[model samples]
Target chain A: MSERPPVPVITPGALARRRLHVMFALDCSGSMRGDRIASLNYAMRSALPELLSVAEDNPEVQVMVQVMRFDTVARWHIDEPTPIEEMEWIDLDAGGETAMGSALAQIGEALDSAEAGPRQLPPVIVLASDGYPTDDIDAGLEQFFSSAAATAATRIAIAIGSNTDLDTLERFMNSPEARLKPLRANNAPDLVKSIKWATTAPVKATSSPTNAPDVASQLALNAEQLEAPSSEVVW
Target chain B: MSWRAGGATAIGASHIRNKRPNQDAFYASPTQQSDPRFMICVADGHGSDAYYRSDIGARLAVEAFIEAISWNLDSPEQINSLPQDIVQIWRRLVKQDIGRNPLPPGFERAPGRASDRDIFEPYGSTLVGVAASEQICIVVQIGDGDLLLGYEDGTINRPLAADTGLHGEQTYSLCLDDAPQRVKYKAIKRTETWPDFVLTSTDGVSKAFVDDAAFVDVVRHYRELVRSGEDLQATINALPDWLRQVSDNGSGDDATLCLASRRYKIQDQ
Candidate 1:
C-alpha cells in the first residue's frame, strides 16, 4: 500500500457569485435645487443598502462607489465610496452654474484608479440631471466619453425634468448602448427606482455591453415613448 | 533515516478531483536548489459565459509563467530585475498565449487581428502568482486573487496586506476582463531568514478565507499537518471540505491553491 497521506475532499461552498462596483454622478446644478435635490436625497438614503445586498457575504465583492455633484464646478460630495452601511444621505445645494463638464471629468478621473476582482464588472457611472446644462454640454460630454478608457467604462443616464435635454443627456452616456431613464416625477419613489436600477445592472468583465443603450429599455425608462432608435449608438 | 533532498516538499495543494463543468488550472515548480527557489501560479475563468474558455486562459498563464522563468532560470539575478517594460511584455505574452488556443466551435476567428487587445477578445480570468528564491520574493496580480507567505516562525503575511480602510478602497486585484491598461502589478524583495511557504489562489480560496487571521490560521495548521509526515496528497484531499467549512458555503467559484515550502535538498541546489 502507498504510504502517502490521503488528500482531503473539498465540497464547494456558496460563494458571493456576482461582484460589481458602481459610481453615481448627480447633477446638483442650480436647476436641481428644491424638489429635485430632495427627491435625489430621499432616493439615495433608501437605495444604497439595497445595492450593497448584491455583494452578500462576499466581503471581496465590494462596490467601491463615489459621487460627484456638479453646478458651475463639480464638487465631490463623496469622493471615495464608503460601504453601503456607512453611506449617508448627501444634501446637495443647487445654486451654482451647471458644470456638467467638470462633473464628467471628475467621473473619468475617479474611475481611473478603480480595480477589478475575479468577476469584476466594468465600473458603472450613472449621471442624473434635471435641467439643460448652462455649461458647454458638448465639451463636458466629450471629456467624459471620448477616450478608450471612458468608452470602456459603462455609463447610464437619467433625465430628471421636462426641461431635461434628452438629446444632451443621451450624449452624457458613454456607451451607445448605455441604459437611460426619464424621470417624470420629482418624487421619492422615482428617485429611488432610478438609483436601484443603475447600481444593480450587471457589468460583467467579458461581455461588457459596450452599447448599453440597447439594454436601457431593460432598465427603468420614462413614461413618454422615446423616438430615438436605441440601436443607433455602438461605442 | 535522515531527511533526504527531494524526499518531500511541504507545499500543500487540494482541489475537488471530480471535474465539475469548470476546471481549475495551476502550475508549481522548484526552480532553484541552493536558495530553495520555487514558483506558484493560478488562474480562474468565469464559468458562465461561452466566451469564457477561461480554463485555457488560466492554463496558459501558469504555463507562460513557468516558461518565462525557465528560459532565464540560470540567472537568479534576473528575477529581481523586474526588467524595464517587463509588465507590458508579460501582459502581451499572456494575451498572445491565451489567444493561441483555437476558438471553440461556433466562434469566428478575426483575421489579421492587429492588436493584442483585439485578437484576445472574449477572454477573461483572474491571475495571481509568485516567484521566489532564498533571498528574494516577487508577487504579481491583475484582477482579484490572493498571495500568502508563511514564514518558518509560523507567522503568516498577505503581500497585498489588508484593506482595513473605511471602505477598503485601496485594495486591488486582477480582473480577466479589465482593459490591458487597467491591469495592475505588485512586487517586493524577499527578506526572511527561515524557510517560508508561498501560495497563490483564485477568489475561490480567498472567499473561503476572507478573514486574514482565520485564513492564515488554516494555512499554518495545514503546513504543520504536512510537516508532521502526513502525505501531501492527504492535505490536498482535505482542502475542499475545509474550504467549504471555512467559507460557510459562500459563493462557489472554482478554488485553487499552489503551496510550496522554501526547504530544498543540497543536490537539487
Candidate 2:
C-alpha cells in the first residue's frame, strides 16, 4: 500500500466585522444654550458625508443611530435605524433642568429595549456631555451598564467642553482609556470636525470587541514608544 | 432569488398621512412581493404639504439608497475601512441628487422633469431596509424607525435605540432639522453561535416593539406568529393591534417594516 504525503491543513482568517448601533446620549441642557447646539448641528452635517461613505464600503456593517438628548429628561431625535446614512438631524434645543438620571435611565431603557437588538459583537455607546449630573447618577449608570439585557455591548464616553465631571464620566465608561477629553472648538469649522471625530472615530476597530485588548496594548506600547522620543505629535 | 432565512422576505407596513378629506395620499411598491436580492421597497408621497413631494421624497430616498448599495457590489472591506468610505460616497451622491451641489457630469439622474412621475423635489421620507445574502445581512436606513431581531432562543431585539424616562420628550424624526453629522452606525458580524434574524421598519412600526426587556420573548412572538405558514404580508398584518394601531388616528406619517431571517433553505433533493 502506498502512503500519501500528509495533506496540509489551512484555516481561513476569521473575518473581524461588526454591526454599529451608535446611541448618542447627548446633554442638551439649558447650559448647552446657544452656539453649542448650533455647533452640534454643524458637526452632524459635516460628519454625515463621512458616515455615508463608510456604510457604502462595508455592506455587511450596518449603523443604527439614535440620538438621546438629555435636559431635564431624555428625548430621542430619531428612532433607531441601521446604516443611519439617511438620518436627518433634529436640531437640539437646550432648555429645562438637567435631569441627568432620567436622561441616563432613558438611555438605559433604550439600551435595554426590544427594539435595540442584542449585539453579538458588542455595540458602542457614545455619551457626550459637558457637565455634572444634577440627579441620581449612580443609579442611572447602574441601570445603563447592568448586564441584564445586553451582556456583550461595550460603552464609550466622550466629554466635550469644560464643566464636565471627568471623574463621573470615567466611572460611566468603566475604562479611563475610553474617555475622550474635551477639545476646544473655537469656530464652526472646529465644531464640525471635532464632532465628526468624536462620532466617527470610535466606529473604527480600535475599541471593538475583537480588537479592544490588542488596541489597548498597542496604544500603551505606542505611547511608550513615543515617550522614548519626547512625546508630542509635532507633525 | 430569495436569500433571506425566512424563505420569503417579510414586510410590515402602515400609513397615517391623512386626517383630512380629499387628500388621499398613501402608497407601497412591488405591491405583493418577496424577492430577497433585488427587492425594491418604498413609502409613497403624502400629497398635502409644500413638500407635497415628500411621498416622492420617501420613494426616491429608499430607491436611491437601495439601488446604490445593490449596484456597488464590491467585496466587503475590513469593517474599519468600509463605513468611512460608504459614508463619504453616499453624502456626495445625496447632495448631488438634491441639486444643491452637483457631481461631475455623467452620473445618472432619475430622468424626466421634476414634475414627472419618477422625478420630484428634495421631498423627504424615512427608510430602513436590509439586503441579505447567505453570508451577509446589510441593514440600511434613511430615517427614524425601528429594526428588531429575533435570536435563536425566542428573544426579540431591536438594533435601533429608543427614548425613555420622563414624559413628553420628543422622539427623533428624520425631518428637516436633522443633525446629519450625528448620523452613525454599528456593523456587527454574525458568528455561527450568534443569532440570525433581522427586523427593519420605519419608526412607527418600530415603536411597537421598542419597550420590552427580554429580546428572546420578542423573538418568541415572531416565531409563534409564523407557525401558520402565512405569507410575509399577512404575518406582519397580524402584528398585535397595538403595533398596527395608529398613534394619531391615521393622521401620523406612514410606517414600514422589512423582516429577514438567516436559515438553511430546504431545497428539493
TM-score, chain A only, candidate 1, equals 0.71
Which regions of candidate 2 fall more than 4 Å away from where they truly are?
A1-18, A114-119, A148-154, A176-190, A206-235, B1-269
Please give, for residues A23-102, the per-residue lDDT of candidate 2 as tens digits: 66777887677877777777777776776665544333456677777887667776564457668766777876666666
A45: Cα error in model 2, Å: 1.8
Over the full model, what C-alpha lDDT does candidate 1 score relative to the true structure? 0.52
Error of 1 at A216 (Å): 14
Q: Worst lDDT window (10 residues) for model 1 chain A?
A: A205-214
Q: Model 2's chain B TM-score? A: 0.55
Once fitted onto the true fold, the runs of candidate 1 whose alpha carbons sit more than 4 angstroms away are A1-155, A160-162, A165-200, A203-235, B1-24, B29-37, B46-51, B80-114, B131-143, B158-194, B208-213, B227-231, B244-248, B262-269
- DockQ score for candidate 1: 0.09
lDDT of 2 at A150: 25
lDDT string, candidate 1, B1-269, tens digits = 11111111111122222132343467666433324566677765434333245556556556655665443444555654333233344456655754576555544443443443333433445556776554555665554567776766777777664322111111221221233433343444444344356667665565544344445565676566545555444455555555554333433445666666544223322
